[model samples]
Each structure stands twice: as C-alpha cells, then as structure tokens.
Target chain A: MRNLFNYIAKYHFFFLFVFLQVISIMLVIQNHHYHRSLFINSSNFLAGNLYDMRNNVVQYFALKSINEQLAQENQALMEKFPESFMKTDQQIFEFRDTLHQKQFRYINAKIINNSVRNRNNYLTINKGSMHGVQPDMGVITTEGVIGIVQNVSRNFSTVMSFLHSETQISAKIKKNNHLGTITWQGYDYQKATMLYIPPHLELARGDTIITSGFSHIFPEGIPIGTIDEFEVKRGDYFFTIEVDLFIDFNQIEYVNIVKNVFRDELTELEQSQ
Target chain B: MEFTALKYFGRFIVIIFIQIMILNHIYFGGYITPYIYPLFILMMPFSIKGWVLLVVAFFSGLTMDMFSNTPGMHSSATVLIAFLRPAVINFISTKKEFETSTEPSFSVMGKTGVFFYVLILIFVHHFSMFLLETFRLDEIGAVFMRSLFSTIASVVVIMLAFLFSGRTKKVRI
Candidate 1:
C-alpha cells in the first residue's frame, strides 16, 4: 500500500491528467446522442433558467421581426374570417373537412438558445415535456423545418438542427418526386447537400424539395429548400446536389413543436413487421 | 488571506459571467467564439496542486459548456491545456524553484514569457476544441482554419483582460 501510494505521489499529475481526460471523453461520448442526456445539456434547470434570463433581454431586439411574422400570420388568418366568405351558408351544410385527419398538432414555443457553426448544431426551446413536447417531435418555423426534438426536460428541450452532419432529412424533389436526402456539409448554413438523387432526372437550378413523410416526423408537402446547384457524381449514378434551405436557422425565433397523433400507432404497426 | 481568497472567488464569478453573457454571443462568422475563461486557469497560484487545478479546469469548462450548450467539448480542451500547463511552465521557466502563492501573469513572468505562455496554451486549447467539435477526419482543413482564427481571437481577448485588470498597464517597461 505504501509502494502504491509512493507511485501515485511520483506520478500524481499524470494520473490526474488521465483521470480528467477520461471523464471529459466519457462526457463527450455520452452526449453524442444527446437524446438521453437531457440534464447534461443546456436544457437543464440552471442553464435553462440562465438562458431564459438572457433571452428575456435578447428577445426585445428581435421584437420587430417577431411582430412582422405575427402580423403576417394574423393578416392571413383575418383573410380566412367567416365574414370574408363570399356565400354565407344560409343552408349551413354540415361540413367537416374529410381531406385532413389532424394527425399532426403543434405546440408553440420560443427558441432560447441556438447554434449554426458547429458540425453538430443544436437549438434549445422553452417548451418541454410539460408543454407536450417529446423527443422525435418535429420543430418548424413558418418558413420550413428547423429540426427534430433531441432531448426534453420539464420546461426545456434541445433540438438537433437540420444543419447537423448526422441529420439526413428525407426530402424529395417536388416536380417528379425524385427521392433524395438533405444533409448539411458543415459549411454554409444556407446551403445543404442533397444525396441519392439519380442523374437521370433533369435537374433545375430552382427545383423545390419537400419532406417525403416516410420518416413520420414531418408531414408530406412541407417545403424544405430549393436546389442551389447540382453535379453528376463521378462513376456513380447519383447526383451531388446543393440546396438553399428556405428556413434560415440563425434567425429562427418562434417554432411549432409537431406532435404526430398516430406516431405510436404507426410505430407499433411497423414493429409487428 | 481571506480578502485574497474572496478576490479570487469574485474574479472567478466575474469571468464566468462575462464569458456566458457577453463573449458567447460574439460569434465570429459562426466559426470562432473568443474564450478567455482559460485566463483563470492560467492565472492560478503556482502552489496549486495538480488535482485541484484539474478540478478547477473541469468546473470552468463545464460552466462554459452549460451556457454554450456544448456538453464536453470545452471541458475536454480546457482540462487538456491545464494538464499541459505545468510541463510548459517547467520547460519555459529559467528558474527551477517557484515562489509560493505566486499567480502567473505578465507582472510575474514579464512580457516575453507571458506572451509565449498565452500563445501556446490558447493555441492548444482552441485546436483541441475545434477538433473535438468537428470530430471528422475529412474536415481537417476546416478545423485548422477555425482553431487558427479562434486562437487569434482568444489571445486578443486574454491580452485585453490582462490589460483591463491593470496587471500589465501599470508595469509597462
């Protein structure tokens, strides 16, 4: 025991370094998924409260833009007012729209924290489990999709942004329905890479891409981006394409957390397979 | 002795406050965040034990990570730099024996010594942080560019901090 003590005393610094380094690396590995490590993230109580305080001060600066967005939405809603209907249904036809099933419900939230520069970027929203937010719920702005909910605490949550390297969002070309995946190249926030697109399709510079809805996270027909550039991948059948995202993540303030009502049902049905 | 301890504690709080509240917001083209919190680590008294220093570094980095929403990236980098600091100091110092309760600063080490000290530590910290943040073999060039820019920015911030503290301004040769 004395010999062991002597050895440790002799190499105390080295041991300390190794010990700390291991802990740090363990933290990094544990936080890689982030979904299960909610408390370690900024969404935790103390961090979340600090950010909330900061956001309270910062939110005022973005008031003009937020007001504009709200005003625009209000104007759109006002246009759909019952008084605006050309024909007042004297014979009130019992009309429940059969076209939409209300599978996706949205919970409004504000982003308290955001990052776009890193390889794996994430955003923290004020809403969490208490606000009906859960992991795998889709987060979106008025413009387009922002990201998917990664970790959720009681009053806060972290979203793995679409800009992350691991997030290969399933998207398809709007014109011919050419299936492709959208991924960030960790460079330009406005630009992203579109993969699995066949070279056979005649690609245009401004081709629209929307979510395929195959992942059950986002609904179909949600506009993701427009093709900014494209090129044939050498020796491969796929095209190396670049897209300009409709949603600017840096300026995103308000978001809607989408809860798919039938997600569990769908998952259960798939699990049986 | 109590006053000095309280002063250091206050400095720790102030530094952490500025880092989270102000410095974290200064996102230089989204690639660099000027991190000067390591200045606290660098300014520790020479008599501080290895384990204590490591603990301080961990907490300092963990604080930054908490605010920045980056879990372990900063902590790992800071701890690595803290671990390397003793060796670097030993290698650079002309005198083998060190005085007790002496904090590292421009006043203690003079201009050249302090410059090299800050340069090496800041560069290593930034490089490790960027590498860990990216964690991709393909973006080696990106990592280098980011680290370089961030190191330059952080070094400037650290120098400003030193000057602002009246650590170097009054002792100008």
Candidate 2:
C-alpha cells in the first residue's frame, strides 16, 4: 500500500490529466446527440449577446471590405455577356438564379462573438430566443448555410458554423433526388465534402447540391454548393465528392436564423413511435 | 497580495476584451482567430502554486468561454495547459536560471527558449482544444490540418503579445 501510494504521488499530474481527459470525452459523448444538452450549448442568448458585442467592433470594419468585394462581384456578375447560341449556359444561368434565390431566408444578425480558427468553429449572434432563434435552427448568409443554432439565451444565440467537424447536413443532387450527407472536414472553411453519394447516380463538375428537406434543420432546396470535383470509392458503391460552398463563410456578415414554426409538432409526431 | 490580485484580474478582463473584440473580428479566411489572451497565463508569476495556476487559468478561459458561448471548451483547454505548465517550466528553466521575479517573457527566456516554450504549450493547448471540438476521428486529417494552421497563427499572435508586453511597471501593492 505504501509503495502504491508513493507511485501515485510521484505521477499524480499524469493521472489527473488522464482523468480530466476522460471527463471531457464523457461530456462530449453526452452532448453528441442534439436537443438533449441544451443547458451548456453556445445558444445561451445572454452570453451570445455579450460575445457578439466583443466581436461587433472588429466585424464592423470587416463588413466594409466585404461590402466592397460584394459590390465588385455583383458588378461582374451583372456584366456577363449574353451568349446567344448555347443551351448549357442558358440552363446554367436559370438554374443559378433559382438555386441562389429559392429555399433560404436571410436573417441579418451581427456576430457578437465568433471563432473560425478553432477546430470547432462557432458564431454568436445578437439575435436570440426572443428574436425567434431557437436551438437546431439553421443559420445562413447570402452564400450558404453557416451553421445551426446549438444553444439559445433570451437575447443571444450561438451558431455552430459549417466549419465545425461536427456539422453534417443532408443534401442531394439538384438534378436528381440522389442524397448524401454534407460535412465539414475541418481543414478549409470554404470547402466541404458530400459523403455516401451513390456511384450509380450521374454526377458532373459544377452540378448543384441542395438541402433535401428531410431534416427540419433546413428547408428543402437550399443551395449548398456546386460539385467542385468527385472521386469514386475504390471498393465502395458511393462517390466522395468535393463541394465548393456557395457562401464564402469567412466573409459572411449578416445571417438568417431559420425557426421552423412546426418543429416541435414534427418532432413530437416523429417521437410518438 | 490583495492589490496584486486585483491588478491581475484587471489585466485578465482587458486581454479577453481585446481577444473577443478586436482580434475575433479580423477573420482572414477564418484560418486565424488571434488567441494572444492565453499569454496572460504564460506571463503569470512562476512562483505561484500549481493549483492556483490551474484555477486562474480555468477562470480566465471560463470568462472567455462565457463571452464566446463555448461552454467548458476554453476552460478545459486552459486547465490542461495550466496543469502541464509547471512540468514544462521545470524542464526548460531551472529555478536558479530564472533570475527575474517577473513571469516568463522573451527577456527572461531569451527569444529561442521562449519560442520553444510557448510552442510546446500552445501545441498542447490547441491539440486538446481541437480534439475536444471535433470529438471525432472521421475527419482526422482535416482536423489535424486546422490544428496545425491555427496553432501557427495562435503562436504568432501569442508571441507578439508577450514580446510587446515588456516588463510590468512596478505598481505599489
């Protein structure tokens, strides 16, 4: 017993570190499934508001530059020469319009506190529970889905940005109902991967991907991105496709937090089983 | 001691404000969020007990977490860093070698020693943080990439802050 005590006392710090890590892992596992660990999420509205205030000043300056960039892009987009003889370009233009404008609503909220450099990126918004922002609500900018609200306080909410590894949403081929899960690989904010897409489905470069509406997190038809590239799995039936996200999340200023009015009803009905 | 405690508290609040306010807003492709605030922990007096260091680090990170809305993430990471600090310091600098009563700084550890010291701690802190944040090995490659890139950025920021922090002007306690 004395020998054991001596060994433990000598390496107590190592033991403590391991013990703490186990606790952290346990907490993480407990919180993995959404809608259960509401108490500790970033969506606590008051904290969200406070964090937003801290970030507001810096983002304010960034917004000016973003606005300038948008103006330039908007100008270039408007000046595209109308080619008279190509059906592909015409079809592309029409598809782009509907995909960009349809399916999502923009809710303008200032980021009070946000982190992008971390492995798990989250954004805090000035809007909160009072503003109809609720847990699991989808957050998007003019570009694409930024994140989902993980926690909500009365006056502020926290958004789990698509940059987070934990972020995964159901998306499908716009041309067909071929479904896959879009997830952040955590390396780049602008890039995401579409997993479990069947190889049998015809996919092409620049094919549009959109939300399937199977999950209440996002409404159907929200444009996620265009297929940047794709590769067939060596021994599998699906394609691991790279998606060029529509929204440049790093440059996003304003975002809309979507609250499905019938979310509770739908969840209750589904859980009735 | 009481007066010094208040001063440190004030410093803590200021660093967090700067971290969340000015630094967070400057998102360069979201690849960098300046985390110089951790320097506050690095700069604390080395003479302080391990438990005190742990608690202070936890509180400082908790405050930032509260403001950032990431519950327990920052606190947990900071605690780990704090816990490892004593071991690192003992390994890097002997009690006799550290002549100054002031905390770890470039002037104290020299540029090269300071770099390695901060690099080790920042690497540990970022590794734990990213692992906790991701909580999955599914995208381990990407998570590692982000961890490396973000660690480099955070190190740059933390180093600059420490180098610029200079000697604390003696305030009468």
Candidate 3:
C-alpha cells in the first residue's frame, strides 16, 4: 500500500496534466455537436456578467461613431419608407387576392466583444435569452448580414461571424437568379468565395449578391455583398467568384437580431416529413 | 517557505493576467500577437520535478485559453513544450555544468545557449498550435507560415523578458 502511494505521488503532476488535457479535449469534441453543447458552452451566467463589465468600457469609446451610423441609417430608412409603401401598394393592387404579406421585425443589440484577428472570429453580444436571443437566429447590421447566433445564455450570446471559415451563407446574384454558396477561404477578411457557380453564369464585376433566404433563419432578400471578381477555369464546371462584404465588421457595434415568429412550427413540420 | 511559495504564486497570477487581458488584445492587424506566458515556464527552477513542470505549463496555458476562447489548443501546445524542455536543457547543459536549481535563462545558459533553447521551445509550441488549429494537411503551407510568424513574435517577447530579469545565484536542490 505504501509503495502504491509512493508510485502515485511520484507521477501525480503528470497524471494531473493528462487528466486536465483529457477533460479539455472532451469539452472540445462535445462542442462539435449541437445537442451536447449544454455545459461546454461559453454562454454561462458568469461569463455573461464578466463580458457585461468589459463591454461597458468598450461601449464608451464606440458610442460616438455608433450614434452617427444609427442617425444615417435612420435617415435612409425614412427616405426609403415612402417608396417601399408605394411598391407594396402596387403589388397589392396587382395581386390583391393571392399575395401574402410577410412582416419583418428587428431587435437592437450591442456587440460587447468581437475578434476579427482570428481566421474564425466569433462576436459576443450583450443580448441573450432574457432579451429573446436564441441560437441560429440571424444577426445583421444596417449594412448587411453579420452572422448567426451560435450560443446564448440569459444575458449574453455569441455570434459566429461571417469571417469564420465554417460559415456558409446562401447568396444569389442580384441581376440574375444564379445562386451559390458563399464561404471564407481563410485568406483576406475582405474577400470571400462563392462555390458551385455554374461556369456559364454571366456575372459582372460589382454585381450585387443578396441572401437567398433558403434557410428559415434569415428572411429572403437580405443584402449580402457585391461580387468583387470572377473567373472560370478551362474545362471546370464552375465559376470561382470573389465577394466584398457590405459591412465593415471591425467597426460594427450595434446590430439587429432577427427572429422568425413561425420558425418553431415550420421546423417541426419539416422534421416530421 | 510559505513566503517564497506565496511570492511565486503572486507572480504567476500577475503574469497570467497581463498575458491574457492585455497582450492578447495587441494583435497587429491579425499578423502578430506575441505570446510571452512561456516565460513563466522558462523561469521555473531547474531542479523542479519533471511532472511539476508539465502541470505548471498546463495551468499556465489553460489560463490563456480561457480568455482566448480556444478550448485546448494552448494547453496542449504548452504541455508539449514543457515535456520537451527538460530534454532540451539536458542536451544544452550538462548536469555538472548546471550544478544548481537555477531556472533556464540567458544568464545561466549564456547568450548563445539560451537563444537556441528558447528557439526550440517556441518553435515546438507554435508548430503544434498551428497544426491543431488547421486540423488538416491540405493547408499545411499556410499553417507553417502562420507558425513561423507566431514563433518569431513569441521569441522576441521571450528575449525581452530575459533581458529585464537580472541573473540570480544557482539554487542547488
């Protein structure tokens, strides 16, 4: 018994190191799946409280610019409201019996912490479950779609930003209906690639790309970005297109979280089929 | 004995706070973020047990990981570096030469020896970290480039740490 204790004590530190690393690995692997993310998630009460304190410091510096941007966006929205009303009126008259109206709502929230320095940057926001924020909800700035919420607690949430390599958004050419999957290639932050664009698709430099809204997470017709460049390889079946995002995420402070009111019903119906 | 232990513990907390809170925020356009926490490992007493070194390295890295939101990347890299440290120290300095428990540093190992020692450990840490982050060989070239850049940044910080801390008498265990 004494010898066994001596042997165990001799390697205690090594065993401790191994044990901690094993637990850390388990946490990482658990994070890879959606269903098992209950405990390993960063959206706990303590982290939320800490980030709330830290965000207070960062928010003070960002308030001035945020106010200016909000004012400008407000002005733009007011100006566009009349035209949007006119368009709706025209559509209503044209298809009064058949057309269904979709209501879009936006929730304002502040980004407390963000990192664009990493290849896969995740942004943390001050809004969470208490504020009605949920995982897979779409987050967008006045400029464009920033990302989707990945994890949420009572008072905080983490956004897997567009800069993340694992991020893929459905986008289509504004001029034509050519659709493609936009993904980051771990290169420059400003540039992202659109995959599976058929070689024959006529794409122009500076053509706008808007969200396809195939996923119920984001509503259809949200602006994504503009095509920066395009090329078709000889004998290849697809066009390699590059995009420049509309929003400058580095300076993004305030965003609007979008929620689909009927998402639960739709999800259940889809799953049942 | 309590006083000395408290002093070491205090220094460890201060080092970790500065490393995670302040230095991690100093990314220069995503190209450079120098990690200087390894200085704690490099400064540990030479006569410390092998297992103790590994445990210290693990906690030191876990502290960094907690702040960075990287689960085990830093911890794993640090443990690997700590495991290799004793072997590197032995290869560079003989037991007869390092007759005391003084930690590995520039003054103890001299200019050239310490440089090689720090270089080897920093390379090991950065290489392991970058490979794990990439998670595939398809982008090996990009991963290698990032590792090299990170290593250069870390080595510069480690050297500056050595320059500031004055030489101490070898403490024989």
Candidate 4:
C-alpha cells in the first residue's frame, strides 16, 4: 500500500492528464450522435445569452440585407393572396376542400450564432422550447431548406446546419422526380452532394432538388439546391453529383422553425410497419 | 501572487473573448481558422506545476468548446499541447538555466525561437483537433491539408500578437 501511494504520487501529473483527456474524449464521443442532448453546447443558458447579446449589437449592421430578403419574401407571399387573383369562374360551386389540410406551421426565429467552416456546424437560434421549438423539427429560410433542430433548451435551440457531414436529407430532382439523398461534403458552404442517384437517369445542370417529404421533419417540395455537376464513374452504379445550394449560409440572420402537425402520427405509423 | 493570478484570469477572459467573438467568425474557405487561444497556454509562466497546466488547459479548452459547440475536440488538443509544452520548452532552451517565473515570449526567445515554438505547438494542436473532428482515415488528405493551412494561419496571427504585446510591454517598462 505504501509503495502504491509512492508510485501514484510520483506519476500524478501523467495520471491527471490521462484522467482529463479521458473525460474530454468521452464527452466528444457522447456528443457525436445526432440525437444526443449535449450539456455544453451554445444552446445552454450562459452561452445562449452571450450569443444573444452579441447578436443584438451585430444585427444592426445587417438590417439592410435582412430588409431586402424580407421584402422579397413578402412579394412572393403577396402574390399568393386571394386579392391578387381575379375570379373568372361564373358558376359558383360550394365544396369543402378536404384534399389540402394544414400539415406544417412556421415559427419565426432569429439566428444568434452560426458557423459554416466547421465539419459539423451548428446554429444557435433565439427561439427554443418556450417558443414551441423541439428537436428533430426542420428549420428553413424563405428560399430553401436550412437544417434540423438538434437540441433545445428553455429559451434557445441549436440547429444542425446543412453544411454538416452528418446531414442527410431526402431530396429529389424536381424535373423527373428521381429521388436521392442530399449530404454536405464538409468543404464548400454553398454546395452539397446528391448521393444514391442512379447513373441511368438523365441529369442536367441547373436541375432543381427539393425535399421529398419522405421524412417527418420537413414538408415536401421545399427547395434544397440545384444540380451543378454530375458524372458517372466506370462500374459505379450511382452518379457522383454536386449541388449548388440556394441559401448563402453566412448571410442568414433569420429562419423559420417548421412544426409538422402530424409528425407524431406519421412517425408512429411508420414505426409500426 | 494574488496580483499575478488576477492578471492571468484577466488574460484568460480576454483571450477567450477574442477567440470566440472575432477569430471564430473569420473563416477562410472552410479551411483556415486562426486559433489564437493556444497562445494563452504557451505564455504560462514556466514555474506553473504540470498538473495545474493540464487542468488550466482542460478548462480553457472546455470553455472554448462550449462556445463553439465542439464538445471534446478543443480540450483534447489543448491538453496534448499542454502535456508536450515542458518538453518542447526544454528542447528549445539554449541555456542550461533560465528564470523559472518568466513566461515564454518574443523578447525572451528571440525571433527564430519564438517562431519555431509557436509553429510546433500550434501545428500539433491543429492536427490533433482536425484528426479528432473528422475521425476518418479515408479523409486523411483533407484533414492534413486543413491542419497545414490552419497551422500557418494560426502561427502568423500568434506571432503578430507576440510582436504587438512585446512592443506594449517595452513601452510599459
């Protein structure tokens, strides 16, 4: 026992280093999973509040661009208003439209902290559980798909950005409806890779890619990106395709958190099968 | 002793602030991110205990991880560099004896010494960080390229910081 104590006292520095490193590695492994709830992320209270305060000061400089984006979105929404259309049908038919029901709801959120350079990027937004934000919900901008909410605190949430290597969104080519998966290659912030696309399908530059709505997270037909380049390697079954994302992640200050109303039902039904 | 402790505490806050607020935002092509926070560890007084250095490095890295949302990567890399710091210092020191209380700086080590010291330590930190982050053998080429670019960027920034601080210290004295 005395020798053991002496040995421990002699190599205590090495032991301490090992101990701290072990704990840190464990934290890293634990936080690697998409669904894991991390305790030390920016969504936590202190970091969230710090980001919020910084964003308050920084947001003023971005007001002009934000206004432009909002105006563009407003014009798009205004074009869909009932007043924008002239009724040409003389025969008035009263029928309940049961085909289209409200399946998705949007909650406004301001991004307080964001990053695109990291291999696994995350964005911290001001809205959280207090504002009905939840994990696994999709986040989007007016132009295109953003990411999925990963962790949520009381007043803040962290979104896994589309630039992340682990991001895999079900997408399809809008022209022919050829389905594939969208994933970021951890390189370009403005680009992603469309994988599992069959080589036989005719692909072209500027082909639109949108969410297929196969998952519960996002609604269908949300634009993801456009095909930039594609080629089939010899003996390869899939086309190696590159997509140019529509949204410039660096300039995004605002996002909309998507809440699928029947998400629970859909997930449960899928699980039963 | 208390004054020294307070000074280091202030430096800790300032370095972390610059790292999180300014340096973190400066991303060059998703390849280079200048991490100046490791300068804090490099500047610690030589008299600091080994275990204390490790502990300080661990907490400093954890704080950075909390802000950046990269949980263990920074901590792991910081701790590795902290562990190797003493050996590197001893390897580079020309004289058999030097002041134990003095911290490593441009003035004390000269241009070449400080440059090599920062280069070695920052490269180690960046390589380990990038390795842990990607954790894939297939992407080793990308990882090496990223680490090399980031290390170059970090070394330049850290040297600039050293030059600026050395000038200020001279003025103060």
User: What TM-score against the true chain A does chain A of each candidate get?
Assistant: 0.91, 0.74, 0.84, 0.94
Instruction: Report the lDDT tens digits of candidate 2 across residue range A170-209.
Output: 9999998888999886657778999998777778999999
Rank by TM-score, highest first.
Answer: 4, 1, 3, 2
Model 3 lDDT tens row, A122-223: 777888888888888999875678888988877888888888767888988888878789898875777788878887777788998888887777877787
Candidate rank order under DockQ? 4, 1, 2, 3
* Model 1 spans with C-alpha error above 4 angstroms: A82-100, B1-5, B95-98, B167-173
RMSD of each: 2.8, 6.6, 4.3, 2.0
- Worst 10-residue stretch by lDDT in candidate 3 chain A? A90-99
Which candidate ranks first by lDDT, i.e. highest?
A: 4
lDDT of 1 by residue, B40-82 (tens): 9988888888888998898889888776667788899999989
CAPRI verdict (incorrect, acceptable, medium, high) for model 1? medium
| Model 3 regions lying over 4 Å from their true place | A1-26, A34-42, A45-47, A80-104, B95-101, B167-173
List residue ranges in candidate 2 displaced over 4 A.
Answer: A1-31, A36-47, A59-110, A115-117, A141-143, B25-34, B95-102, B105-115, B137-160, B165-173
Top-scoring candidate (DockQ): 4
Name every residue pair that clashes in candidate 3.
B101-B171
| Candidate 4 residue pairs in backbone clash | none
Give lDDT tens digits, candidate 4, residues A1-273.
999999999999889889998988888888787676458789999999999999999899999998998899899989987778777777444475535887889999999999888888899999999999999999998668889998899999999888887888999999999889998898778999998999888888999999999987888899988899999878889998999998899899889999999999988998999
Best candidate, TM-score: 4
Candidate 1 CA-lDDT value:
0.84
Model 4 residue B14 CA deviation in Å? 0.4
Using Cα atoms, each model's DockQ against the true complex is 0.67, 0.33, 0.31, 0.73
What is the Å distance of residue A94 in model 1 from its true position?
Answer: 11
